[model samples]
Each structure stands twice: as C-alpha cells, then as structure tokens.
Target: MRLIATTWQPVWHETPLGWLDRYRAALAEVAADRDTLVVFPEYAALEAAFYGTVTLDARGWMQRGANHFDAYCDGIRALSKDTGATILGGSGFARKGDQIVNRALFCAPEGEAWLEKQMPTPYERALDMAPGEAMPILATRFGKIAAVICYDSEFPPIARRFAEAGAELLLVPSCTDTEQGASRVEIGCRARALEGQMIVAMAPLVGEVPGCEVIDVNLGQARIFCPPDGTSPEDGTLAQGPRNAPGFAILNTLSESLAQARKGTDVSVFAHWPESETPQNPPETRNFR
Candidate 1:
C-alpha cells in the first residue's frame, strides 16, 4: 500500500483558522495522488499553543474542553471524507466529560475513526491528560495497523503489545524539540520495526513555535523504518522546514520484506549475537575471577 507521511512545518503561534487554511492547502498538495494514506505529526493541530505560555507543568493551558476538542475531531472527520484518504490525525487533547486524554484519531475514507494512544508521556502528565487504557490494532486493506504518539514509542512494552496484537505496521506521530530529539525518535522507530518485525512510520512537526523549545529552532526530522535486509525499502525522510521547507515523504509501497527476512533466519543482528557463557548463578567476584 502507498503511505504518504506529511511532516508539517506549522508556525507555532497561528490562530486555529489560520492553521486550518495552511493545513488544508498542504493536505491538498500532498494528496494530489488520490490513493495515498497520509499521516501527520503530533501537535500540528495546536500550533498556537507552542507560542503561548503553555508549559509542560501548566495543566490549564493544555485543556481542550469538550466543545473545542469536538470541533477539532469534526474537522478531522471532514478532512478524511473530503480527501478520500486514510489519515492518522496525529496527537491532540481529546476531552471526555471533565477529563482529557492525549489521543490520536485514525480516520478511514468512510469517515469512520478509531482513537488510540492510551499512554501519555511524563511531559504530558503535567497537563493532567489521562493515559488510555486500550491499545487498539486496526485492520485495513493495506495491513493490520496500530498507532502510538511520540513518547509511547520510547517504551518497548507498548510496541511489543501492538506486535502481539497482530499489528504489521506501526505509525508514530511525534513533536520533538532538537535535532537530538529527532535522532532519538528515529532510533526508537527503528528499534520498534526491527523487534516487531513490522514497518514503522514516524512524522514529526518541523517548524518553529515561538515559546516551545522544539518549535523555536531547527528541530524537525521525519523518517520511516523497515527491516535491515535492504528488502523493506529505504527509510523515507521529510524536511525540517523553514530553511529546508515542509513536505510529505511518500512510501510508495508498504513492503512485507521485513517479515520475509525473519521467516527463515534471525534478521535482528543484536538478537543473533553469540550468547555469553556466564553461568546463571555465578559466584560473586571477591577480587578473583
């Protein structure tokens, strides 16, 4: 299946309407090819907050009360219907009654959505966004897919659970602040793909937002990960924005080459290393070998 990963370079301080216009144009440009599945990065929807006084410790700033968050979801629904494309709508503050959750919306061409991202990172905890309880693996014509936002991918258990639940493709929507941040995220993407024996696609926000550290500098990087046998295709990368410019990185085909690599031989080099001969209950060293 063809997957188009859109790494947005949103100006952090723009109004919702302004952002909508820019995003709509970007989406139109990226979706020029009708049959593509597009994925946006985290926080691309709330660029305004980045330039504001919203700190990780300030819960009030991150609140997305029912009416507002619902509107966002409604907009996403419309986007999916209009584009006739499947979208992993990145991460956002979703309200459920008086509580909020760090959530991702996966909308199919039929205008139906499946929400995921059960766990929020420590940074998100400041906003009092509740962690999700269920990790859903979606079934699509392309493959069995699952999505996790930013920090969730840092944890091995979460990726493992998705793999166990039969997800063949993992999508990650991230918002990171530094080039190092991008590197770290990309490393995790690779690790997840290798360990799960699946394809991993990561889209990160690539522009500056005045107040937020990540958005204020040149810190955006996006990449796709596959198995190492040169069979899964190259890792797709998107621009860092401003100087580099914003655009989409298209994965023309979601190859199952990684799975093929693991069929007869261990494709994970780290897992295949010779085991150490140390005893299970070796005596404690006391200045002697």
Candidate 2:
C-alpha cells in the first residue's frame, strides 16, 4: 500500500468552491495509482471560513465549522470516489447534538466513515470543543487502519489499542502552534510506531494565515515512521517533508511489513508489550539519599 500525507498550509478561500478545488488538486496530485491512501491535517475544515461567510475569530470557528461542515465533507467524499483512493480528509468541528466535537473524516472509494476525536487539546477545549469516546479502527481493502488525532497520539494506550485490534497503518492528523507542540507530536508519532510496530503516518497543518486565529501560526511536517527493528529502516523514518513546508510525504508499505516487525531481530517492543501489561511486583523503593 502507498501512503501519502500532506503538510498542509492554512490559507483563506475566497469561497467554498475554492476550498473544494484546493483539496481536489491536493488529492489529484497523488491519486494516480491504486492502493494509495492520503491524509490531511486536523482542522483543515476551519480554513473554509476565511471566505468571510463566518467570523474569523477563534471564539467562533467551532460554530462556523459546524455550520458548514457536512457540505465541504461531501466534496471530500467525491474526491475519494473520483480518485479511487482512500482519504483521511483531516478533521473538523461537527455538531453532535448539543455538544460540538472534532471528527476525523476517513473516506474510501465506497463511502465515508467519521471518527470522533478521543482527546482534545487544551487549545481545543478552551474553545469549547468536546472529545469523543475513543479512537477508531477502520478496515480497508489493503489492511486495517486506525487514527489518533493530534494530542491523542501522546497516549500510548490509544495507539496500543489499535495495534491490539490488528490495525496496520495509524493516521495522525495534527495542528500545532509552537515548536514545542510540534516536537511533542512528532515524538509521540515515533514512539507509537516503535511500540505498536505498525507504520504511523502524521500530516500536520503549517504556516500562518492572517485573520484566522483558529489555525494561524501552525507548525509541523508530514512524516512516516515504522519500528527501528532489523526488519525496517534503522532510523525508523520511511519518509518526511521539509520542516513546516507544504507537500506530501509519500511511501510504500509491504503487506508483510507488520509481520516482519514482530518477528524481527530487536528488543521486540511489540511482542514484549503484553508481558509488560501483566501484573508485576512494584519496584523496590529504597532511601539512597
């Protein structure tokens, strides 16, 4: 399977049509082949509001995104169908009854599946966003795929659950505002790959768009990683884009890649995880000082 991820940049669309065209072009660039999966960054939907139909204030982005969410999402579904590739179309704020939640839109050629974010960042919570129940694992023609949105990637159990469920590719769609935030997310993605022994792909939103306080001053890049065991790349990185640059980080994964990770010559993080979960005696504490 070929994986492509976008280091997307935030920009103002003069209209909703412009937003759809941008996504269409982005997906079109890499959808020429079969068995390809592409991902965009979290809150990519927020960019559509810059056209002036809604207020650009951070306080109002959630509502604006909710109002215009489904229509833009339909456009993404059509792109997936037209390209014949599965797409994780980033995330957006969608109204789920009285509460508003951020959702990851995963679309295949057949249809669309929405995954609610299990964790919300401080920034998102401050903006009055509610989190979902848990991360989701979606089965695909190639293999089982899963997603851990942005801050959710920081949690080991979240990624571990997907691995336990027989997932192979883990999608991480993130949007960050600072160097620390970006590095933390990068570290989380790498750690999850090592622990799960599954390919972890991250696509982030970059650049600053004036008048859009929600996703302005974004950070991070598109990167793909796997376990550093003998069977995979020693550095654990399969592909990555230039820092904060807008482009796609593309790579191919063998169907046997996950199989190799567990049986490879190494510390066996994935295999040893279950043993670590077993009940063990507490570490002996001593007063050395």
Instruction: Give a tens-digit lDDT track for model 1, residues 1-289.
Output: 5776667776744355555556567778765334667788876655534443455424444552223455565666677777777777756666666777766678887535555456676666755678765447777776778888877788877887788677888888887776777777788888887777677888887765555442355355556666665443344222122322476767665544324534533355324422323456776767765
TM-score for candidate 1, please give it.
0.78
lDDT of 1: 0.64
Of candidate 1, the 10-residue stretch with the lowest lDDT total is 235-244
Rate residue 44 of model 1 by lDDT: 61
Segments of candidate 1 deviating more than 4 angstroms: 12-16, 32-34, 48-58, 64-67, 211-218, 233-245, 255-289
lDDT tens digits, residues 1-289, model 2? Answer: 7888889986777776788888877777766345888888998877665585444577677788788788768877877777788888878888988998998678887666787788888877887788886555777775788887899999999889889888877899999999999999999999998898888889999998776677768989899888887857778888887788899898876465656656664777877888887758867889999
TM-scores, in order shown?
0.78, 0.94
Candidates in order have lDDT scores of 0.64, 0.81
* TM-score between candidate 2 and the true structure: 0.94
Model 1 clash pairs are: 118-132, 177-214, 208-215, 209-215
